[model samples]
Target chain A: MKKSINKIVMIGAGNLGTNLATAIHKSGYQIVQVFSRTSESARKLAKKTNALYTSSLDEIYPYADLYILALPDDAVLGFLKSKKLNNFFMVHTSGSLPVSVFKPFSNKFGVFYPLQTFSKNKILNFTDIPVCIEGNDKRTESDLMKIAKNISRNVMVLSSEKRKQAHLAAVFACNFTNHMYTIADEILSRKNISFDLIRPLIQETSEKVKLMKPALAQTGPALRKDKQILSAHMKMLAKDENYKKIYSFVSKSILSKTK
Target chain B: MKKSINKIVMIGAGNLGTNLATAIHKSGYQIVQVFSRTSESARKLAKKTNALYTSSLDEIYPYADLYILALPDDAVLGFLKSKKLNNFFMVHTSGSLPVSVFKPFSNKFGVFYPLQTFSKNKILNFTDIPVCIEGNDKRTESDLMKIAKNISRNVMVLSSEKRKQAHLAAVFACNFTNHMYTIADEILSRKNISFDLIRPLIQETSEKVKLMKPALAQTGPALRKDKQILSAHMKMLAKDENYKKIYSFVSKSILSKTK
Candidate 1:
């Protein structure tokens, strides 16, 4: 039987970090410490999780078995490189940052990437969230898996290279797709149309992908080769050069994929 | 009290048309007739709805109180322009096609655009879906509203111009967003990562926007202004110029919006 992850120390009380801390606490793990660049963030999360808070990195207590570097991907490496591991297992919850980031610091290096787009206000259901994990060794991997399984149901022991690829995919799936929503919102705002009108379709589009392959499920004027409607839409979008450019580019891309 | 819409005749059984027929049927409205250029499509929809189907445009039975032209935007104008009105209330379920398309056909001309992306296999909930309607006059508008309210809980009486803008927004929200999903799926496939991992994030990202403005809810390396991770992702995507361009474009776009 695997042992439970009793205590966890989260570094970086930003959106992902704060949410993860709360989720961990809710999952019955005790958050031993919360650290952030700002005192307010550290204190806020500490209050919520009943964990010790500190703005200073050196003041971090090594009471916990695991340390999660939930800072920005760039900051994660330097933060890891700056500190000596003190023989405790450390993992960075970053998609873009590599597992090798903690190589020089400790042999017990790993990644615990929660593949989800999170916000401070929105509570996420970690049950369905995919936890992509990696470790330098088998023991470290097993330890991280036990921790991950506690918080999330879906856990995958992926290699560092595979994690990198998954992160890149996340950029497209989460970041780029959100950008598309912003564009849609902007277009609606400009026309005095309510953004709420498109909300159902946006939700449905995401839901459909859960059951079907995106390629097989793709639909639009572009895929239909409706030159007339495309031309009319282009004419309608004549004033907005950027949107017109995007329409042409995406239409061409979808057509290429369909072909 | 509004009379129930029992008879619905659908013109142009393409993607939108076929789906609308299915939706109307599922919503307890009787699809009396289905017309299409292709015999196969008309037959398929007719079989699904248990309605009379015809390939010849002239053979369209005027059995329904409501005629829905789920046709291509341009085809709508040409089709309606040639037809003589027989006092039947007609509406084109189009976002781009102007209400003027129905001017020559009937004074009861209006629009019943169920603002959504519909595929044959994917079942949609009409209750939450917005039905953007417009009419040539007040009586027709009221009649159209009655029809819309019968199928959907959320119905809005939008002007022709507003519907056009909504269409543009739909392109951004539905069509373009789906394209982004396609891009994400492609990126993940190329990297040998299952697209399933990012599904939760994609769903959450949209769900977040329902309660919060997309600009405020957006969370990504791009919005965080993390240059290091951004550059790292760029480096990884160096070989794929298309993805690289998209990353840079969307990152810049999102940052601009938040700023």
Candidate 2:
């Protein structure tokens, strides 16, 4: 058994940082400090969590047991390179970055990736969100796990490589999935159709996956190889070169799956 | 006031047909007949619905008030062309095919498109699914509405042209969205990672659309114009031309939305 993480210093008060800080605070842990190059973001999250805010990396409270770097991927690399890690355990909240990036920078390191899309304005209960965690040492892993378990119900240990692959997979599951919705919104808005018409369909598509694989749930002209309807759809998209390319590429990909 | 439909005949006992048969039956309407090109499917749905089954167009009960052509678009056209009207109202359960397709055959015609993804193995309540209806006459529209209302709480009138556009949008929203899941599945499976890890993310992405525009919910390397990460992701897809093309096309589309 490991001791619980009592004080957390949050770094990079972006969407993930702000959300995580608030969730951790609500879960009865203290967020001792919040840091961001953007002063407004840092101060905003700090006020919410009742933590000290700083725009300087050097100002992070040294007494905090955990530091969550929740900046963008490039910014994460920059923050790691620019700052010297105190003796605290460090982790990132990115989906894509490897834990190795924190290797040479911290005496205690791990990853604390929350596998969900976070928007700054939206408040979510961390209870059901999966938190994928990894650490270089057993105590570090358990301490991180303890922190994760305090805020989330679904925390699991994952290796750096597995987490990277999971992150790549997430690019499709969340990022590309939202991109598809964006395209649908564009198509309907052009026709003056309220996107409200498609909301139930969107929800049902995701819900079905909880019961079955997506490949089995797929139903459309592309999967059916209905050349007539596919051609009609392609012609509809012909006005936009980029959308046409996407339609063709994804249609062909769906067709290839059957083979 | 429009009289309620007394007896109904179902065509195409595939995914949509099977699901609708159950819903209509559960809604206290009589399914007089079930038709399918495959005898096994026709009998399977008929046994479940306690209706007569037929693989032949000639065997359809001519007295049923509503004839739901839930078959494929081409199969629908083929069924219409091969058989003469029995003086009953004809409607299709397709999003793409126009109501005009039924005009050439029936004295009364319309569409009864349920705007939800359906699977034969998965059962769903009709209460929330949007039912898009259009008919040649007021009575035809109202009769379809009665049947639709019996099975669903959401029933609205839409023209054939608008329904076609809505169907096109559905392909992107539901079809392409599921394909994104398939792509994610492939990516993780290659690394022997369980897709269970991403299920929460998938559910949350869809849930976000309920609260905000999907375009606003978008996040990833492509949207941020993070060149290094985007390049890294693109290289990962280099092994498959189709996927690489899709990744580039969608990424550029996302970038365009910011402008």
Candidate 3:
């Protein structure tokens, strides 16, 4: 592979990879090849980026300087085991995994984690997503930052530890919050109440967080410690042990934090 | 105060009461009196709505067409105990409380629960709030619906049973979701990370729910059943018992829901 980190090879055609590659290609960067174990998936992303598709590792283009292993954590680790390719500037887009996972393979390895959840069908505006960059060398760092900064308005250089911590926070903010919505859907559906009723409140809650701290933005019965209503809600979820436990646990947690 | 439903007497100037009264006043209704056990609170709301303020029960306006007992459920019940209401169309704003709680005091008793979380400083656009109306008589129900519909775009005529169920759902959608944000804030702050990083994600998650079922919109390690990342997150939160318990419980709940 060339020493200049311009022509790129992308590994993986998953949600994150597809979005990342598409964004990178849109930003006037060259995406030369897209590789996935599944040929259809590889072709899907490759076609969008106008890159060659391959299901075989041996078919990975040799001239690309930037090799993005935007694969799953285990896949990234497994790929590392093969002692792959030239001394290219390689990186993985993982939240929990440390950047050091690349140290053994290349002299300049890095993390280019996109701090946003990617789903199959959604088209997220790149400007709104935060890109987290970490690297083993300044050259790698700057190159990765150039790519990330090119694609997103929000870019932060966080250590793997800090990135991992941020990822944990995201699980709470995004994952747990989505689960709460799912639970709300379950409760309302059982009662024939549409989820449409609460979407405004949910969106407002998020909008409030933008203007103030989430701690300050927090509200609802739990913050007030309205035990009567809390108990009544708990009773309403009695048939579902998971829902009941979640309700009490989060309500008490909010009370503890606010108090 | 007059026999016409144009005049309203607002009781208990708490968050809901304050917002409810303001929305009603803005919709061209005359708020004759704003009452609270605390003179300061009553005065605060009264000044905003151009209504008279009073702390004493005996000073309540005698002829207002509608009396909104916007107090806590217990306070609402307590007010009903003293037989203090004049024969005005009385209603209490409570989610879980039964509408019949006012039946003993007035022949035209009803419930006017706005199904949205209210805060002291936030200006809620009543146009987005879903007001739930229940009444002892058709006239009371219609009157409550007229006022609710005038101020808000969403109105539901639900019985106490259905309102309670929706209230339970609201706890999950609004209360639990806010707590999730709180937990995310705590996690990030411990590492000195700004909560700003997650705000966009939170907003997007909520927005996704508006277009699709929350169950379909759900993403993250929990839904993917990524055991490694899940365990890693749980370990990251191991120091805080509350967080650890919540992480595991909610993760399992999401897993179950997705499966």
Candidate achieving the largest lDDT: 2
Complex DockQ per candidate: 0.67, 0.81, 0.77
User: For residues A150-203, could you state the per-residue lDDT of candidate 2 as single tens digits?
Assistant: 889999998877777787778888998899898888899998999999999999
* Better candidate number, 1 or 3, judged by DockQ: 3
**TM-scores for all candidates?**
0.92, 0.96, 0.96
> What count of clashes does model 1 give?
0
Docking class of 1: medium
For residues B190-258, write the lDDT of model 1, one tens digit per residue. 867787888888888778887676767777888888887788888988887666766777776776766
- Report clash pairs, candidate 2: none
Task: Please write out the lDDT profile of model 2 over residues B1-259, one tens digit for every residue.
Answer: 6466878999889889999989999999999999888999999999999999999877878888788888889888888888644457888898888888776677888999999898888878999999999999898898888889988999999998888889888998999889989989988899887878799899999999997999999987787788777787788888978878888888888888886
Which residue window of length 10 is worst by lDDT in model 2 chain B?
B81-90
Tens digit of lDDT per residue, candidate 3, span A27-136?
Answer: 88999999999999999888899999899988888878788998877788888887766476788999899988877777878999988777757867798798999989
Q: Quote the positional error of residue A74 for candidate 3 in Å.
A: 1.9
The alpha-carbon lDDT assigned to residue A233 of candidate 3 equals: 83
Best by DockQ: 2
Candidate 3 — which pairs collide?
A: none
